[model samples]
Target: MKNLILLLVTLLFIAGCTSNKTEFKISNNGVEAQVLQLKNHQISYTVKKDGHVIIDTSLIGIVVNEKSLGSNSKIRLSERFSEEFDYSMFGGKNTAYHKTNISKFEIKEKDGFTWFLEFLVSAEGVAYRYIVPGTGTQDVKGELSSFRFPNNTKVWYFERNNDWKLKSHAGEWLCSDISQMPAISKMGPVQGLTLTCEMPAGGYALVAEAALYNYSGMRLEAIGDNTFKANFAEGEKGFEIEGDILTPWRCILLADDLNSLVNNTLVPSLNPKPDGRLFADMSWIKPGKAAWYWWSGKFSTFEAEKRTVDNAEKLGFEYTMVDEGWERWSNKWETITELCNYAKNKNVGIFLWKHSNQLNFPENGYALMAGFLDSLKQTGAVGVKVDFMNGETKSLIDFDEALLKLAAERKLMVNFHGCQQSSGEYRTYPNEVSREGIRGVELNNMKEGPLSASHNAALPFTRYVTGHADYTPLAFTAPGETTWAHQLATLVCYYSPFQCIAENPEYLLKTQKIQPAINFINEVPSVWDETFVLPQSKIGELAILARRKGNDWYLGVLSAGEKKQLQVNCNFLKEGNYSAEIFSDDILAEPVPLEGLNPRANLTKRNTAIPFKKEVIICDKNNNLMLNIAANGGAVIWFKAREK
Candidate 1:
């Protein structure tokens, strides 16, 4: 037994030498704490008894430089703590570059056992204050900041006072006076707070925290010692890209307490099974006949709503979308209920509009709107169009999931707007019918011209690769629109089972030119068995995609701003004759020949070059087939391969 004790002591001595060590000092009647710095970014502490705590206040400095202009434009400072901390930018209004005054920091005692760290940035004149509760020994807190997005300057750039203002590129970390005020919102003040800023040169972010430790019977493990929460105000300005503008507030939170932190800010909550039929059961979504209208203006008046519904049914459109504006003014649950019943009586499913604020219900507001969702179910609404979400924090994430679950339970579908990239959430919650994350055709109606073929071509590779994006396809020759041929090509190039024709039902019937495309749209299913990003022979100028549902294969190719020839191949198919139907440049043609088709066919055996000037084609291997495409155009092909 003595020898065993000696061996255990030896092991303890060796472990002590290898482990990292951190030290802390307590003040303010054994509540406030200060941690000694470590050589590396990581720090560790051990308390001999209960009610001990440690506080960390490490700040990271980021320097941003413009690659195109060879200039260093801004510096961002950030930090994190154990409890909540106060933070603000000091010089947001200053347009002139001031080398002498950049940023200042300070830490001091406030109330019992509590300490305050104040951060002041020069360009924005914003001040941030943090209040950290003091614990005995085991409690932990810290701060960190980093540089991101040096390649693009315009992403975070905003115009101030008609002059281009910038942030400092170099600064030092200092401990100074704590004079910054606590953060406040239009609603009210917040607790457990942190502050962040974006400089002119590129992107930058920071975070901090504070907490308490040494009370009797305060079990650190029971408090879920691994987790912590940080809250910040959501940005109010809308996001602007190139010349287009969109409104959605966004914020980011960082933490060393990985388990304690939940990234819920700005995430959408949508589910697949909405208490009724699965998405696959929506047979009305085939490609043939669909239409869209800006829901708010069109549906606000009874006469207009009756006209839209009657006209849509008369034109034989399978579906119609009620865009934004419906939910903007109607705060009562009865408003939605009435609208839903009216739409149902007209034989059209209503797609209601909702903003992130409506979903959150703002603290105590959830109770007043508690019956809003129940009304949607009672009204027979098909789906809700949700938009303007701009954060990814834990509470928001939880809310997102809750909304999806609630919508599912109520049997209503969902379409998310103002979202980050899709993260396979739709697969889990299939009732999350669609999302808008890419630059789509709406931009053409609002600001810039319609989305270019290049933009459409780039999507299947970058954004669409993530999952479903409602691109609102096929607007034929509206005043500022692309050609009819280009519009037809999008039905195939863009992937969405619940696609929008983006034209009036009356217009569609009058033209009668879009009948074939509408037929195809109605026939296609929303979910696919497989999707492939074909290797493009060219970059930025062209892209091709192939998808399958059941036994049918669909292929789409898009070209941007240029004419080109492509050697189409069937290498992905079996060595057998397949029937194909092609749609290109407003013309629907019969199947054509794809000869010498095999798994190993090379450039020599498969030498057919399809001429394209923004066009699409569909062909079978039994006969030679060719179709012409318009400038800035695309093509869609449906084929049936014989069994091996």
Candidate 2:
């Protein structure tokens, strides 16, 4: 009788412990996630795709004012609701995400704060954020969000803004055991803000942040074995905000293949919609190629400025950017107005450059910018490129947003250089065109070798996935271990709304040798309506991309320093015949061994040009195109749909 009583007591104890914890299941399509609301304000979640666990119950919470929300703290759910909606984007992959599910819960903390927890699951990935209510202003101490994956996961980590160690974004995408992962450091060897994980359980996951406004950018620091914690910029003590605070959305892009990572719209979807009035008449905002004087060793002289404008007209470019030296005149308006009139006469717009510090004065800062821009608008200046904002502090982030709005009000376009990567800002402010966050072609002056064909191959999947990267491609001075065809393909491979032509105008436009390649660059569009990934594209090896603008299709293939052959079937075309124009590496052209050498030696004067040759093929029901790319070479095909 005593043994039976003890057995009943043990069974009752197991039931009590289980009842304290509650599990919530949310799913969309093939991806499903389960979140557990545990005792003491602690929470955990596990994400699965097609019944295979991708994220294994990772801890998620925040730390505020020295109080730990992920640890021992009493809390209770006040309300729960689920919402579904679809919204349009001004500039993104598509019109909408089709369907989105938002699950929200209001939890009241016993210690005087109420937190609104939200989990948003979509076809692309899962996102979540925390909103603390009832506040005039508050300082967030830190965040307690973490990702604890299963053992033996592989990751493609790009060290963020570590120009000190990793020059020109050149480093290994180290694939190693998750347990051996090192913590991310701000000023040490190399650390990353973006973590792309190849899960051990049959799928892929990308850990990144979205909707970064009025908050410091987030980077992952490995805290333990197979675990990473959220770390913000170190100069500030968390974010300072007014009224109720809605933090940036932390997203996990889960997918089965590389193509999804390129096409996922989660980051832009998290951002607020564009101000309808700002975009109601977007005809003023034009995205096109421009000529720049910086890379050509030209300064603020009439001859240099006129040279760039002449080249802009020669190459059929839409704008010419006068870099920093234009500000040398004490009466800046005189030189700027004269140059603007010169560019206007040549039918090319003007883009000016400014230092961030020169525009930071409290009294005359914004007012001076307004007056300066107002004067330039009369001379037909279209945009301005602001540079040297080196950190992601709250003040800087807010300043960036303010500048975009101010530029928009003045009917001027904006591009941020030396700034953080695009966090869907273009969606909110359509006037904001491009940013130079990635290590771009300009780094060739400082580093060598790694910034070659392999680096170009990795960008479309890693950096371009974030947003518009102002790489300022198409350099004719030094091709850098790549053929002219490979450089031509970069015009199509790298997507920038505001692309700058970093070539010498005298060499690229005046020379007759490369006019065939230059002719194609003159016609390529800066933005696309649709994009497709081709097969056998491996990072650091090769990149094949297909993009659509209007009714035409453009295919670009970039190859590293290895002879390769690929047979491409035109089956992706509509059920009709098409005409294909192929620009590939000339097998018969002299193989110039230019790798690891000073790039300036190969330049030609205005009279001498190196000509290139390509083939034209007609694709029908019975044709499969064969591409033979040489070492450090590339190919591009322009296909036009034809009637049968």
Best by TM-score: 2
TM-score of 2: 0.88
What is the C-alpha local distance difference test score of candidate 2?
A: 0.70
The digit string of per-residue lDDT tens for model 2 on 1-644 reads 43234223323322232333767777888878776766534566677778876776566667665555544434344444544445543332435463567777665556655677788777788888887764677667667676767788886665434463222233334345677676443544224445677777755787877888877776666655466666666523566677766778888887776677777777776788778876677787888889887875745665788888998998899998888788786567877788888888888988999888767543655677666667767766889998887766667777788788778877888988877666777778878878877767765444432256777887777667757778888754566567777777888888777888877666776656566767678888888877777767876678888777776678888788687898776655556667788888787766544333234333331211122467777785356789888777788888877865
* Highest-scoring model, lDDT: 2
Clashing pairs in 2: 513-611
After the best TM-score superposition of candidate 2, give how far the Cα of residue 473 lies from its true spot, in angstroms. 1.6
